[model samples]
Target: MNMHKLVKVLAPAGIAATVVTSAHVASGDDGINTVEAAESTSSNYKYQGDTGYGDGNFLLNEALIKTLEEDGDLAFNGHTIEASEDDYETRADKKSEFVEEHDQKFTLRDGTATKVVFPIQDETLSIDDVTEAYGDDFETTESKNGKYETYVYKLGDKKDDDKKNIIAFKVEDGYVTQGTIGYSKSY
Candidate 1:
């Protein structure tokens, strides 16, 4: 049996990134077999689940990209890939932007969603309804002018010690004007 590992390091905008790949080869009575595993620890964030919009919930990661491309509810506005030194890295890494029929916007990095914004033109979500769904485990911030308030809910259990998942809603006059869901490092 033989094992090989490959590591790639990259830094963009002062952030250190690392990608690790491991391969194992074995030859015996069963002839030869190879297994490979790859992990990118560049970002401390990991996809947990949907955005908690009930039936409208959209999960992040590559599956989201594939779903949007296939789902008839969304319009394919196009996407852009980031250029890197390695061809594999360049092909694997990309930032995709998508818009729903109601004008909701989503921005994904490397197939993982980094941000989602719901426009005011869409059907307004009630703050009371959101509270009823997610409970009271959240933080609130109000604008100085008292015109807007933002409620942020930290999603995920204690098992997710390193990663942080959050869903936020911006409300005005008791109606949610916008919403955002994101995954990132805890620290």
Candidate 2:
């Protein structure tokens, strides 16, 4: 297995810049495959090896959202899908919006959840804890002011396709404050 690491600096005002590191593994000559760190291909995302969180599934796509709705685990927060007047080319082109319920914030694109943010609220959550829960194969960014930090773990090969899946942690004061799991068309 070969590990690749890339570092980048982004200077956004008041926000932390990023240092991204990713690992790629090659199959051995014996035909045995070594596990690559921080890779998840399933539609349902997980944190700490569990899928359920906060009265519903934490990170879900369109199909899983529908299933949760049917199972009474999720519901719309009374906000209807409305497209902007000029950008309404088609139903599929509508802008993504957030629907909050069950203490989870779901970003819906075309009535499907593309991203979900949930509260961590664990004062003991640390960077090492996040690394253990997910993996060390992640990209990290810290605030310019040194008060905030974020770690992003890739779910799939972003270089190979347009679809992006990731798990992210937002830390403040040396502790993780929140988490997010989602997918996007591009990152």
Candidate 3:
């Protein structure tokens, strides 16, 4: 099959559609088929493989994104993504859209996730959740952006920290929306 057609067929699974197609083409049927190529690409959405959670149990990667997409009823770290039609919405930003529940949000860029927002929907997650999750190793800054009061966290509190991932929590009525986990983009 042609590269364009293959990529278009798999684009719904990833932003690296062309890359996946290229890999498939390069493999030349060496036990790698279209479905396997797509699945492998979906499982490897890269973000430096870091999740600022307990013991770093969860790494926010393509598997997480696929779970949130394929199975909408996923719960993690005291947050949940409800399975409802209204739970998903497309944003004006070309790179992103979001699937939100009453307390959690997942942001996708070109069908792969770049952010996951967790709110204080339960005792396990609160305004101090990120600090607790990342421990004293994180850096924080408070700011107000329009109607949103944000608390930003940088994973490692250092001047030359190599980690590009950051999390931000939105507060309203004195309650944290818990926080958003995302990575910086370079164009």
lDDT of 3 at 107: 63
| Backbone clash count for every predicted candidate, in the order shown | 0, 0, 2
The estimated TM-scores of all candidates read 0.42, 0.47, 0.35
Clashing pairs in 3: 119-177, 119-178
**Most TM-score-accurate candidate:** 2
Tens-place lDDT digits, model 3, residues 1-187: 3333444555676556334321322323464323334433332322211122222213222233343333322333233323222222222254656665434466655554555665343233344544454445444444434444665544422343333335455555444545565543310
Q: What C-alpha lDDT, on a 0 to 100 scale, does residue 35 get in candidate 1?
A: 31
lDDT of 2 at 147: 77
Query: Which scores greater on TM-score, model 1 or model 2?
Result: 2
| Candidate 1: tens digits of C-alpha lDDT, residues 1-187 | 2111111111222322233221112233575433332353222221212222332322222222222222211211222211111212333347554534224455555653354555442333577867876778878888778888888765544343223345577778887766665432220
Greater lDDT among 1 and 3 belongs to 1
Relative to the unseen true structure, what is the Cα RMSD of model 3?
Answer: 15.3
State each model's C-alpha RMSD to the native: 17.0, 15.9, 15.3
Off by over 4 Å in 3: 1-94, 101-103, 122-133, 145-151, 156-163, 170-176, 184-187
